[model samples]
Target: MRGTHPSRRLGAGLLTAGLISLGLLPVPAQAAADTNLALGRAATAGGANGGYPASNVTDGSQQSYWEGPLGSFPQWVQVDLGTQVDL
Candidate 1:
């Protein structure tokens, strides 16, 4: 579980430490939080090729496909998230 629940997290941490101290549980390795900030976010492209729009990338329709403007070198694609997010 995530650490969002403080009371439960504190209890778990205390229990884990106690167990490790008593040699009942081994110390765990560190790991990064697996959070996907881009899920469901909008995408905007500099241009579109025919009917392929940038929105196709995140439209929730896995079958949809996107193609940036043809022959446009180094096109600009941006994610228009409504709020600031930590990468």
Candidate 2:
């Protein structure tokens, strides 16, 4: 019976480890908003007419986040209630 060379076996092990590590990588949260809810408009910076309110815009704020192309993709807003709360 033939067996894989020591180097080949090591390479395979490394490859498996790499794949597992990649899979374990943390994934960013993704969000989607309804058209009628004005979520889509806010994603594009087009909701400046106080649709959602200027003070409500979080964008680069520490609480809310907006990602991806200027117009494409959904806006991501992460909210913390200071503590867990049931809605």
User: Which predicted model would earn the best lDDT?
Assistant: 1
TM-score of 1: 0.47
12-57: candidate 1 lDDT, tens digit per residue: 9999889988979865532233554555788888898999888777
What's the lDDT for all of these models? 0.76, 0.46
- Name the best candidate (by TM-score): 1
For candidate 2, write residues 21-50 as lDDT tens digits: 787544333322222232323333423332
Q: Candidate 2: deviation at residue 47, Å?
A: 58
Please, what is the TM-score per model? Answer: 0.47, 0.26
Q: Name the weakest run of 10 consecutive residues (lDDT summed) in model 2.
A: 31-40
